[model samples]
Target: MNPASRLAQISFTAGPAALLAGWFLLRPIHGEAEPGPWWTAGHLAWLAGFAMFGLMIFAMRGLAGPVRGGRRAAVEAATVVALLGVAANLAQLAIALHAGFTASDGEQMRALLSQARAYPGIELVVYTPGAQLFFFAVLAMAAVLALLRRVTTVSAGVTAAGVVLLGVATLQEGAGTALAAVGMAVMWLGTLLLGRGPSGDGLPATTPTRA
Candidate 1:
């Protein structure tokens, strides 16, 4: 198998899983009563997913190198994309853990609400768009890396286009949309790229050297 191909496999396995695992997280709401198990459950699920995603990224790092010339670019590209994804999960983990301390029970919620009323400092950190954007950007990059490893022409083209487009979105709405778009576009392009390869004569220029 080609080194690039192996990296592709690694990204495909871990990248997608990481993205899925860290999909959506909950944010703090000011002046709004968040007093319910149902609302809290969603947050818990998202946090769990983020943890699994972190593990997935750790797994992907082991798939690097030994790639042929052409494959090197793709592997590097994928690495860039995946690293951002890991960062996103780390941010979420921080937020989730902090919440545990503050959201212990009705008393805590009420107390935090009072603190927000008094100072509003918590609101700033809890609702900062920057953290959200950073997280999603990483997630999107993971998708891009995974997709990059797959097919090139159609799939790679599509994924690249997606990366740029999602990047734009990330700049706007935050990282969540960007990462979602990254995952979608990367997967689409990768599968497309995998469908075709180069001829031995160097016509299509498909495939890396066999492992």
Candidate 2:
């Protein structure tokens, strides 16, 4: 494969893996109100995960490359929505990390979460609509591209499957990390298929033109 394709595949694969790592690393800090120094490690792990996720977004943009007409417009608009959600999620995580590290006592951390939920702002917004939009927007884009035959069927199907896993993961307790990990793995496979040329793999990188 070309260097660009290699990079995109790596980014797409590593992004979710980083997130899974973060989740595992942060497990220790889950319910601990007065967490030890280990909490710092958890926070840092998540930060790295999110950063990698950002890189994944960049790589995804590269995959899309150039576009024209309605397809271009759709890709651009959906990308914006996904980016917004990513930004919001990062901001909320930053706030939580800040609170966790700086607060003198558990009371302070508790207050922060309480206030965040009480107010209509980043904290609540991030996990709610922001996260939802991030997943749904990507799903929508994949669906649209698949229907238009602009993207590989395998890529679209895997992404849509991942979306379902993520949606279910979000609702269940203690399932987020595992579900996300599996989902991302599926997406990685899809992305891998996308990067493969017809000569390298039987799968068509693009749908065949109908006569």
Candidate 3:
């Protein structure tokens, strides 16, 4: 693989690492009463992971270029857009949670939640449907990659399963979400596989051939 592809692979790996860290940090204290420093740390970790994943998604688009097929570019583009949208919402949520948790006491936290609820319109327009779209968009990318033989069949299947698990996570909370995080961690491996080129296109430090 070339330098760009090598970098892409590295970024892809980082994406999942960040996400897993975030989930680990956040899972314990999520929605718990008497939130503490760990709760804030968890949210920050999760959001940071999501932001890195967004960058990885963009990097993967370049790695995906060699594999040519029907609408490959379009699918990749849509995935970038959708994933960025997901990242944006994650940031928003993290901010809200941090603000709420930092409030002086219970009364202040409740007030913050109340004020946030007043803006349901934002969620309606963006986060609500956008997150669902992001899930399908990622699944679509996996399908396209599979069709193009850019990714292995098993990778595609795992990707699809991961997306579904994440979607299910949205509806429920607690253990189910943790399970979904595990599935997403698996999907990250699939993404790592996808980042590498079959032809060694992105390996670094190739010796030039003399004529």
Candidate 4:
């Protein structure tokens, strides 16, 4: 594979791995009263993961090749939505990191976070439905690629399952974090499989060869 394709593959694999690592790091203190070193590290990992995810989305778009009409439009739309989701996620993480750094104690951190959440649309956009859009968009793009034969149905379905598990993980607390980690692992495997060409080679199916 070329440098660009190699980079995309690395990002695709690393993004979810980072998320899983973050979840594991945060799991021990899932309900801790105060933000501490673990919390800061976890948030940092998530920030990096989401940033990589943004790159992964664009790489998937490129994998869709030079198709026109609805196919191209679908990939492009998914790419935009996924990037928006990534932005929202990053914003939320940044807020959390800032709160952790500024607050002297758990109560102060909570207050700071609450104050930030109280901002108009911040709760909705960065916390819930808005941030979740990224996973949905990624699943949509995976399905589109499957339809285009750019990726296998199994890979797309596994990815969709991972996304669903992650959504479910958000609804729980202690054990849910573990679930989220598993979900990220699943996503990593799915993307790894998706990145392979038709011959089961490691390179992306749409990767171009040199003359």
Compared with the true structure, what per-residue lDDT tens digits does model 2 show for residues 1-211? 6875555556655655665565566567653554456556655665665665566555554445455677667767877877776777677667667777778777888787667657666545776767667677767667655655556777778778876776777667443366766765665565455434223342234433322
Q: How many clashes (backbone atoms < 3 Å, residues ≥3 apart in a chain or on different chains) does model 3 have?
A: 5
Q: What's the best-to-worst order under lDDT?
A: 4, 2, 3, 1
Clashing pairs in 3: 1-202, 1-203, 2-201, 2-202, 2-203
The lDDT for every candidate, in the order shown, is 0.43, 0.62, 0.60, 0.82
Cα deviation at 96, candidate 4, in Å, is 0.6
RMSD of each: 8.6, 4.3, 5.4, 3.3
Could you give candidate 3's per-residue lDDT for residues 1-211 as a string of tens digits? Answer: 6775555567656666766676676556564423566556766665665666666666645434543344666666767766856665684556556665677765676676556646756555445665466566667776765665555677678767766776677567642266768766876776666555334343222222221
Residue 109 displacement in candidate 1 (angstroms): 7.4
Candidate 4: worst-modelled 10 consecutive residues by lDDT:
202-211
Q: Which candidate has the top score in TM-score? A: 4
Q: Which stretches of candidate 1 lie over 4 Å from their true place?
A: 1-65, 68-81, 104-150, 161-165, 174-211
> Comparing candidate 1 with candidate 2, which one achieves the higher lDDT?
2
Candidate 4, superposed: residue stretches over 4 Å from native: 31-33, 172-176, 205-211
The better candidate by TM-score, 1 or 3, is 3
> What would the per-residue lDDT of candidate 1 be over residues 116-159, giving only the tens digit for each residue?
43554433443444334434443344443344442234543554
Report the lDDT of model 2 for residue 85.
Answer: 68
Candidate 4, after superposition: displacement of residue 85 in Å? 0.3
Which is the leading candidate under lDDT? Answer: 4
Q: Encode model 4's per-residue lDDT on 42-119: one tens digit a residue.
A: 889889999989888888887787787888788899999999999999999999999999999999999999999999
